[model samples]
Target: MEVAVRVLPEGLEPIASIFEDLGTGGVLIEDPTLIARYKDEPGDTQVVSALISGQGDLPVVKGYLPVDERLPERLDNLKLLLDNLFLEQRPEISTSELPETNWATAWQAYYKPVAVGEKLVVKPSWEDYCSEDGRVVIELDPGMAFGSGTHATTTLCMQLLERHLKGGEVVIDVGTGSGILAAAAAKLGASKVMAVDNDPVAVRVARENMVLNNIQEVVKVFEGNLLQVVTGLADLIVANIIADVIINLTKDVPRVLVPGGKFIASGIIKDREKDVQRALKETGFTVLEVKREGEWAAIVSILGE
Candidate 1:
């Protein structure tokens, strides 16, 4: 069933709590800037209410449950919980028509080969991309998941990988969106590579890309958030997610690193670099280098002694 939630400005915190509590399919952030600025208490409680979409003449019911209950019951409680929260008033929503096609095929029209440093090139699977002068080619399809190596963050991360990754090292890619970084690690001769993402779709897509690259066995893909489900120490850990998630990850990334393990992070705006660096410092990582392209930045850090 499709469910749409309208959260007033003040209700955003509760909405975020609901997403975290219910493990919902996917969240479409209407106001990402506002959500990014929200501050949360350590033990904040949340309530979730599920209401049927496009159901006419049916009275909606809302229900409340503690965070530990099964997801189905939490979803069942949506209508009741929403009724109390909104007092039975439906929020106004606008819909519009746009040109549509199979996005996978449509995306191919705009996809082009991108050069990431002197040694590496990223090409779409539908295109025939040949590297001149013996450069490394990473063939990928930018499906519904993000990270196709065209973003400034991905390019910066790849440049860092080109420089720092030594053969036979263990590497971990946190938030491995399309398994791009993990595949690059395999190509660079990393002895072991593990890629993890919270989205199962992302994990599936990453696995498919790994197979396309003929490195499916070399790069293992796992479905989970951050580094929680990942085991073993890594010589290199690369995370290309938002600034806030990167900061949260820094608190635990060092623990999964060998003594001299290196950490590479991107997907941060230039303005947020200092804050992310501070968070990394608190987690025993010393910033070794910073690379900038346009409005984005990537940081390389080594575990502190």
Candidate 2:
């Protein structure tokens, strides 16, 4: 089953994250800027190419799910999630039976190389990128999960990581989707890292990305909820999850983070920034900085000011 949503380009990832949460096997983004760039003949790929062609400049986010007996229920849940996406009006949701081969065909056309922070460049494993000017490139194939580092939420967190991490600090990545942040922490010089995600599919994809980056030994990917599987204290904790989850995560952050350790909370929708800030402040964290990019914000704080 292929699920498609027409969304504003800036708001793409939030909707993508919902499909991810529902255990999508893969996501194929349709960026409107390249209508002329990709043209499929009227055939197997016609569904995808047609999807890409229309809509003028509006981008379409697509996710793949197995056409199983459980698909109807999953679709219902996905629709529910989409309906609550904090938008002024509900966006359109469309679905169809997609061929497995079309997944790669669409991915190649839209998933281009993206650079995050000063030196952290996220390139797809199939894409080629030359590392220069002190760039630290993390090769990844974020199948099904949302942490591709292209989204503003993930980008803000990566940029914050570059600024805050000095070296050799213990780190924790909550909701470690695709393990991108954990890979960033290791590449940025964390000594040891704990990467946890509640979703089994995300955990598997993250571990694969770790191996792709060859940081598996440095960053451990495990299946666990926000902080349940966390054992030891960490010098820094980065979470690129939503505002409600981030707000709920505040109570346990200080417990697992070392004294004065940095906490980077992202995946926050702009409207809920103050709500999250108040939650963090109530939990005794002093907000050090907040970085905003295209309708998303990341809050950087410490255990103790």
- Highest lDDT model number: 2
lDDT values, one for every candidate: 0.77, 0.88
| Alpha-carbon shift of residue 111 in model 2 (angstroms) | 1.6
User: In candidate 2, where is summed lDDT lowest over 10 consecutive residues?
Assistant: 35-44
Listed per model in order, the count of residue pairs whose N, CA or C atoms clash below 3 Å is 9, 0
Clashing pairs in 1: 49-78, 50-78, 50-79, 61-79, 61-80, 62-79, 62-80, 62-81, 63-81
Clashes of 1: 9
> Highest TM-score: which candidate?
2
lDDT at 31, model 1:
47
* Model 2 / residue 120 / CA error / Å: 1.2
TM-score of each: 0.68, 0.72
lDDT of 1 by residue, 1-305 (tens): 22445544555455555555565544554443333233342322231111112323222122223333364575555545545555334532222323345434676787898888878888889888767778888888757778888889998999999999979999999999988898888887888899999998899999999988888878999998899998889999999998999999998997789987999999999999999999988888889999999999999999975
Tens digits of lDDT, candidate 2, 1-305: 77888887766888888888889855788786755455543545776567565755677888888889989999999888877777765677888897877764576668887878687899999987898767899989888887877788888999999999999999999999899999999999999999999999899999999999999899999898899889989999999999999999999998899889999999999999999999999999999999999899999998878
